[model samples]
Target: MVLTLTTFLLTLLSIPLLQKLYTLFYNAFLHPLRTFPGPPYVWTDWYKCYNDVYLNRNWTDVLKELHEKYGDVVRVGANELHFSNPSVYNDLYSPTHRWDKDGALYRVFNQDESSFGYLTYREAKARKDILAPLFSHRATCEMQGIVKKHLDRMCEALGKREESSDMLFALRSFSLDCITTYCFAKDVHASSAEDFKHPLVEAMDAAVPAIRVLQYFNPWRKLVFGLPPWLAKLTDPNAGARVELQDMLLEQVKEFVEDPKRMEQTSNPTIYHRLLDPSNGPVPSLKSLHDEAMSLFFGGAESSGNVSMLGTWYILQNPSIESRLREELREAWPDLEDMPRLEDLEKLPYLTAVIKESLRLSPSVPVPLPRVVPPQGATLSNHPIPGGTIVGMSLRFVHQSEEIFPDPQTFNPDRWLGPDASSLNKWLVAFSKGPTNCIGQNLAMCELYMAFAALFRRFELVLDGTRSEDLTYSEGFLPFFNPRHMRAFCRPVEA
Candidate 1:
């Protein structure tokens, strides 16, 4: 009886000591991110990160708040750090010396082994080497006629829509049609009077929201993909949607392979032709080709579409800026019937400023792309961040910095005009910097300039019921301004 009583006494005495041990373990070994100063719960739980991202909440705003409390650089997670100082751009994203693109998040986004967007850095470099010539100025100049045909179709569709119809929906369909035509050598005609009924379009729309969820709560991708098909669907809605999309894409590719003649007939000497021809070098396997086609199709459609839509929305909201932009277009081209050449568009100062301002205000790629620290560790703002750390610079934070851009919230295109505009232009890292930056940036710019100049010159846009500042943004793999929530009233301009 005496021995049992002694054992009970020892057990009771050890509870506080065990609690202290647990805390020590968390601080020293188990918690690799403990040194970062973020929200109290962020270190202990990842759900905190998801909650902020999933709701379309600006985590950059949270980072700014932390920076206010912790200074220019702060540890925001156990193994994550954020640097708001613009100087960090040189260290983080500069071409001469920069981190590689093997981050866990990037790997998760790669849909297949053969997918161009999913390839490793070395493989990507190789792919870029092969593909670079296709996107060159010479190539774009050759393809201008093909692009213009689609833009003409888009303008006709816009003309038929009720004056106040959602331009966002119109732009989405236009971009999808343009991209799919470029990829498949055929028109999906998603922007036409007949609504889009294509299986691919339906499957892609369903997949986007699911992909966003996956991105926010990154799971063990291999384990997730390894599960039984039914079990995987039950656990991950994105997996099901992805499967459906992949099947449709594969079928489309099979059709192309079966009828090489069809591809030849429809081909306009595009990137698709280059990718399919062995003479062009390293033609991907059928599966890889499908993955790449889908990647290019979706990336081109979504990113460019969102930017064009937002640029339109921003111009509509700021009338003075819009008027100035219209004046510039008028002065440069003067004839709406004859489309401005690429060289002509380049010389329009106010048009370029308006585009710059739009990109600054509503960046389609708003989030900071995460980069893994190198083996030797890295320095940001003179602070030594340990190796294996996940570091990023938020576009939202950098573009909106009061130091870099005074009156940052206002849509002021004038900031990009005049002599001092050169200084301000240096900080506009919308497409990011370095070799890993967007490959389709030039194409995107050309499309935007054409679409904006065409639409604004033909129609006058007015906000129907939505206020510019109050417009909602849909959060997913990429954030797009919610068009369903925005109602714009348009009226034809007198020629």
Candidate 2:
């Protein structure tokens, strides 16, 4: 009886072991990507899990090293390949490709019905069309007042700081406030929080790092997101904000779905007007409404805030750069009381160059936006990849390319000033390229432009012992900068 029991246990375990072995064998020898080269265990998805989950190293940084060792293309997962060549970016992510986004990375967000979370080209395109009217350039131009109001409130807080204020948190607060008001007619009022330590902003900062955990072990995402507010607060008090926001969004979605006409009661023309309009098409499910709300908030706030923060830091560090920028701003608006319009700001060549450089240098959404090759298969870097292969190229590969942006590390706005600058515009993939690119970029651009104009023009900034490494971040879906953020003393100027 003892021998039989032992034998049963062995059989049960060996079956899976044998299955794993066969998978490894097939991936190593018979898989479509078999010819691709990477380190051992690359045949298993766990190779990424080990690097991203176990070792907790930056996956993009690891890919950079792998590319250096294995040449331009490296097989990073069983059916996944990553390219380090800048030229391959356009070829793989062409406007016409209409490739599906890889689900492994996107589904972790837990908003699959929303535009950013949609995997198929058709689904995403449909949502994008419905929402395009609200995010059009003209819409953004008209809503400049809302952007400026939040910017003014943020700067007012900075001006009142006793010693120093964190630009990252402050900028993120401004963004969160702007997005909530602009999109939902909900004023989260994150900007009013003392020292910019609002619970939602803190929760968001914490959440960015946690995304690494969700990426490799997605099942845990449901568990993590499913926690009750009290339990979440017990886990981490800041997490309470995340849970609270989820509940609020759920309630708001239900309200709008039940009475679409009630949108007229909102403080502004909220996204509900577009999303719930019958003429646009059928209304989405309740869950989709909530998902779209979260998607728009995150999409609007995070990168814009981070990029503007980057611009502020870079400008403060270089006195000459700041001087040149201030000289231009002063000449453009000699009286501090008379601020220029968004249209006027857009026409400032130096300011435009500075904004472009800021977008170029900031590790805006640093990770690769993964997309699946179509079922018919596709060519990347002139190599034929299988239909189901996962392919991506990090923006770092393109933005920091020395061949394209010389002295890429330096914060020189002059790069965007040259006669050849127009030719380089194709490589500026900050908003990304193609149909699935960021839909709310118009609003984000307006925010970025207004942030720079207001801050540099309204006050003189002095860094408070923030070193270069303080700005450095590890790779998550977003770059995770923590333990230290850029702090500055904002002294209001009267000219």
Candidate 3:
């Protein structure tokens, strides 16, 4: 019996070895990507998971090194390919392309039926039409009041601080408040806090590190999410906050359902007003509504928060950047009491350049946006990619490539200034491109411009010297900066 058991265990162990040998042989000589060059074959997918999930290595840096070693196109995994060519990026991500969002890769996000996680082009397009109008220019203009209220609160709080303040917390508060207000008429008041550490913000920050783990190993999520509330809190204390966010969203939805007329009667009619309206073609199911709300809430909050935080850090690093930006802000709004309209802010060439340059240098979403080739097949950068193959372009590759932007790593808003600026727009995929690009981009831009103009125009700022490592990051779905990195001392400029 002991000898038989040993044989069975050995056979099970040998199965994986045989599978590895098969994969290597197939990838090297029999796969469609057989001719493509890559690093020594060692299970690229597991290597990626180790670096991204375990070591917390920056994926942008990892892909950048691979591109440097293997040229513009490199086979990064058994069935996955990475391209660094900007024109090819335009081709693959363009609306004209047939590439669909990669199902296997996107499944990790755990957002089902939500636009961000939609796998089929038809369903995604249908959903996009329903949600896209809410983020249009007109909608953003209408929503400006909610944005301003939060921005004003943030500036008011920051102005009262006597010591160097942590901009990460403050910026996150502003973003969290803006998004929650947008989702429901209720405001989280994250920005109104003196300490800037709102409970929801703290919970969201705590959950991020663990969420990245579930993103790679998704099956375990079922186990984690299935635990009873009390036990789940013990396992992932922040899990309660995540549930609370969804619960709040559902509660708001319930209000709309209970009294449909209340949508128009509310003090702040939010995105939910349009989504839950009966005149709308078809209302999403209750779970779908929650999924959509949660997706938009995170999208609206985290991306803008990161931009506000990282942009401030970089702008302060260079004295000239601060000088030029402040000059532009002061010129645009001479009286500190007079706030510039969002449209007027858009017209400030230097301010626009600074925002664009910041988005390029440290994009909020700094990871690869993967897409699957269609059954008809297509070629990227002249390399024929067979249908069903997973392919993506890392924004870091396009943004940081010396081939596309000279001195790409260095932050210079001036690069975006002048006749070449229009041409440079082609390579700017910070908010991504084509049909599946970020839905909240217009609103995010408004938040960024408003925050920068409001804060910098009123205060002269300098970074706290001891917090240099704050600029360093570890790879999550979004760039997670060391919270301590963005501390800055501010003084009200003598008008």
- What are the RMSDs of all candidates, in order? 5.4, 1.5, 2.6
Q: Stretches of candidate 1 above 4 Å error?
A: 1-36, 45-50, 53-56, 110-116, 193-207, 220-248, 252-263, 276-281
Off by over 4 Å in 2: 1-10
lDDT of 1 by residue, 204-228 (tens): 5555555455654566555654577
- Local accuracy of candidate 3 as per-residue lDDT tens digits, 255-333: 7777888788777766677677667668878777777787787777777777777778778888989888998898888
In order, how many clashes per candidate? 1, 0, 1
Q: Which stretches of candidate 3 lie over 4 Å from their true place?
A: 1-25, 42-44
Clashing pairs in 2: none
Query: Highest lDDT among the candidates is held by which one?
Result: 2
Order by lDDT, highest first: 2, 3, 1
Clashing pairs in 1: 33-78
Q: Indicate which candidate wins on TM-score.
A: 2
Q: List TM-scores for all candidates, in order.
A: 0.83, 0.97, 0.93
